[model samples]
Target chain A: MRIALDAMGGDFAPDAIVKGAIMAAREIDEATSLLLIGKEDVVNSLLKEYGYTGNKIAVVNATQVIEMGEHPTKALTHKTDSSIAIGFGLLKMQQADAFCSAGNTGAMLVGAMFSVKAIEGILRPSIANFVPKLKGGYGVILDVGANAECKPEVLEQFGELGSIYAKYVLGIDNPKVGLMNLGEEEGKGTVVVQAAYQRLKANGNINFIGNIEGRDLFNDKADVIVCDGYTGNIILKMAESLYDVLHEKGISDPFFDKFNYEAEGGSPILGVNGNVVIGHGVSSPTAVKNMVLQAQKMVSSKIWERFKKNYNE
Target chain B: MRIALDAMGGDFAPDAIVKGAIMAAREIDEATSLLLIGKEDVVNSLLKEYGYTGNKIAVVNATQVIEMGEHPTKALTHKTDSSIAIGFGLLKMQQADAFCSAGNTGAMLVGAMFSVKAIEGILRPSIANFVPKLKGGYGVILDVGANAECKPEVLEQFGELGSIYAKYVLGIDNPKVGLMNLGEEEGKGTVVVQAAYQRLKANGNINFIGNIEGRDLFNDKADVIVCDGYTGNIILKMAESLYDVLHEKGISDPFFDKFNYEAEGGSPILGVNGNVVIGHGVSSPTAVKNMVLQAQKMVSSKIWERFKKNYNE
Candidate 1:
């Protein structure tokens, strides 16, 4: 398995990305390779400075770099030779098992949708975030800023995708999936949520556990929580701020310490044809390293293949 | 000023409600009176147990009781003689300056809508929750589960109602109102939020600050944050859970300590014809006392009258 890394993506750029790639290369099996995609000199110099001597690591040079604030589509279209663009090209050609970027999220999402394309029957591809649970395990939350205003059918699909990801990626057996709603009752949400509830309840593939409120975000009540991207995004960001508050106050604890973005690595674009993960823009070296490892785990688990099979079933 | 209290409302009804009323009665001015509405015998016994009270306190009999689990509208209609009902009746008849309850949220909302009625031009009444800021002081967030899904026009009304509440009750001078979106950019949310943003920006009545994200909920960026009730409720509950998690983990700081609902009292139903506050159903004696005091503050500020004047202007 070969995982392509966008070395010029994150805030730390070549330094953090290169350092992370080197760390990931050391940990990954010999059969699993790392492809660092970026400008030749910059990446090579970092690899040399870091004293990387791993046979599992290699660099694929791309001349251009896309800045963090650029328009995703415009950047991808105009900067065809950029590292992120080249990373996607490697994944498209089946030269790499997965591609990860800590670059412009909008660009990463755009590349996933237009470059690799969505699955055959999927209405819209959704992104999933890992919420560190109080019970010492992680819960998967989907469409976290992906499709802000999703239709009922689209939310129902998120439930299926989230379930598969949780089961395969997170290794939760028969993951309990709950719809993120205002109330826990049968008919206790907006029009879209109400319609989605009925469909989720009837869907036999997923282990639907009715509704879960925002307070349940960290609880172990459900392994996978699904919602429209609008609600999901707000919940995700709000949870992220808790860590920020704790950091600012100089208070550190075991539970809150898990909230660091670097530990969780990156949020994956689920429901796509290939394995693609988008890390935080401010991703550190450890975060980039974890992103590569996360990609390796997803590929080894064969999540996309299993997803296609489940959808067909 | 006379404030009617729902003596039978809340999880610890009669005891906590009556105790809070007594505490409030003693603290209020001699001219201000308290009308405790509940079963006459139950309320009188509690008052007697707490020792003979002042002449400023009185009891009004209410035979029916509304349970927490009952449907809100059904309970309001069937239990017309309930404490919540009689409290509204007193307010509607000008017998009381304001009314407050720590009862069924749905019932309180229903009674507020049907009993007191909304201000003429108001599209829908919104409830505002107090968010404890990290930098000390508090920010007001509106439509916190009042209207789960609001139209752009309704959100615009929330901005006005929230602004008025912040100015008069909270005493913020020229409150900076913000449209809650997924991102801070101009066009970064659902269609409804984008439309609301445009209207809020164009309206000269409000001090619009463009857009704010979930992270700003605890920050001092804007004094008033407006969003659809669905989003508002989710954020509110999630924020509440952060306090809960911190408490359970034994992490105590001055900032997180202020997250206690008792300190904030209760959420108020703005955009209504009369002052109405709804405390948490599980409110303790201190929380109930705070709710009563909040109602007193609202009445003293004459928020409803000012709201009417502002809307007319």
Candidate 2:
């Protein structure tokens, strides 16, 4: 298995990305190899500077860089030789099993949709972030910023997509899907959410656990929570802030520590034809390493294939 | 000052409410008195059983009771003698300085709208919940479970309303108002949110701080956070859950303890003609006591008159 990573993506870029890759190399499966996509000279020199003498890490030349502030589509179109563009190029050509980045989130999303594209029957590709469950495992929440707004149909699709990911990648059996809303009652939510609740309940492919409130996030009620991108994004950032606050206060717990983004590293773009993960822009070495392992899990599970089969077959 | 409370409301009912009233009578301002509304016989017996001999606690007879599951509008209409109905009646008649309840949330909202109603020029009344900032003092977020969806103008109004509450009641000076969104960029978030951002920025009455993300909830970015009811409700519940989880784990901290509903006691209904607060349905005696004290604060601040002046003047 080959995992293509954007070494020139994050705030720390080559420095943190390279160091994280070295750490991940020590623990990653022997069958898996790392493809570091960036300016070949910069990545290699950094690797040498970091005192890395490992054979598992290789540099793939990409001449241009997509700065974090650049427009996603514009950068992708103009900087064809950028690390992100090249990483997606490798995935589309089957040269890499998965592609991961800690750079531009919008670019990673646009790259996934434009290059490998959504599956045949998928209405829209969604971004799914991992939810740290109170019982010591992770659940998935989708549409976490991909589509600021989603139709009832799109939300229903997220339920199925999140369910597939949870069951296959996270290995949760018959995962319970819950719609995040203001209240648990069937009729209690915005017009769109109320409609989405009905659609999720009608669908039979996954276990629909009715509606779950925000308080149910860390509980054992639902393994897969579905909401529009606007809501999901807020929840994700809020939980991340909780970790920041707790850590700042020197209040550390086994469960609260999971609130740290570095614990899971990256969010996956589901329903796309290939495996893709987008890490935090300020990702540290540990975060980048975990992002790589998350991608490894996604590739090994063949989640994209399951999505395709769920829709096409 | 007379503060009317629904003695028959909440899961604990007359027992906890009576006991809570007794506790609140001790700490409450000597000028303020409690009007406990419920079945006269039952409430008096409970008051006697709880050994409350305080002259500040008075009982008003209400023959009926509104159960938690009853429809808000229907119960208020048919059960005129219900404790919730009588509480609203006293507020509408100006016989009570403020009214508070640990009862059905829907009923509380319905009662506020049906009785004293929204202040003149107020588009919609909103429910505002206290935010436990990472620092020391508290902030306020509005439209929590009151209006599931809000228009751009309604959101702008929330900004002003919350600003008033924070400054006048919470004691924040020149309180900053922020529109909650998926991203901090002015162009980000759903269409309604984007438009709301524009309206908030254009409005000259309040100190608009532009858009704030979920991570900024506890930060010093904005003392008054504005959002549609759906988002605010989710955030409020999620924060409540955080407190519950921490308390259950026996992990106590000054900041986390503030997350408890008992700390603030109830969410105030802003933009209404009268001061009103709705407490948690399962409120403990401490929570009930705090609820009464919160109502006292609202009455003393004369927040409803301030709302009238803001819009009517």
**i-RMSD of all predictions:** 1.1, 0.5
lDDT accuracy of residue A24 in candidate 1: 90
Docking outcome class, model 2:
high
In the range B135-206, model 1's lDDT, one tens digit per residue, is 778889988888889999999988988888888888899999988887889988899999999989988988
Clashing pairs in 2: none
Task: Give the Å shift of residue B20 in candidate 2.
Answer: 1.0
Work out the TM-score per prediction.
0.97, 0.99
Interface RMSD of 2: 0.5
- Model 2 earns a TM-score of 0.99
- The 10-residue segment of model 1 chain B with minimum total lDDT is B256-265
lDDT of 1 by residue, A55-133 (tens): 8878999999999999999999999999989989999999999999999999999998888888888899988888888
Over B196-255, each residue of candidate 2 has an lDDT whose tens digit, in order, gives: 999999988899999999999999999999999999999999999999998998988898
- DockQ of predicted candidate 1: 0.72
Error of 1 at A291 (Å): 1.5
What TM-score does the predicted chain A of each candidate obtain versus native chain A? Answer: 0.97, 0.99
What are the RMSD figures for all models against the true structure? 1.5, 0.9
Candidate 2 chain B, run of 10 with poorest lDDT = B45-54
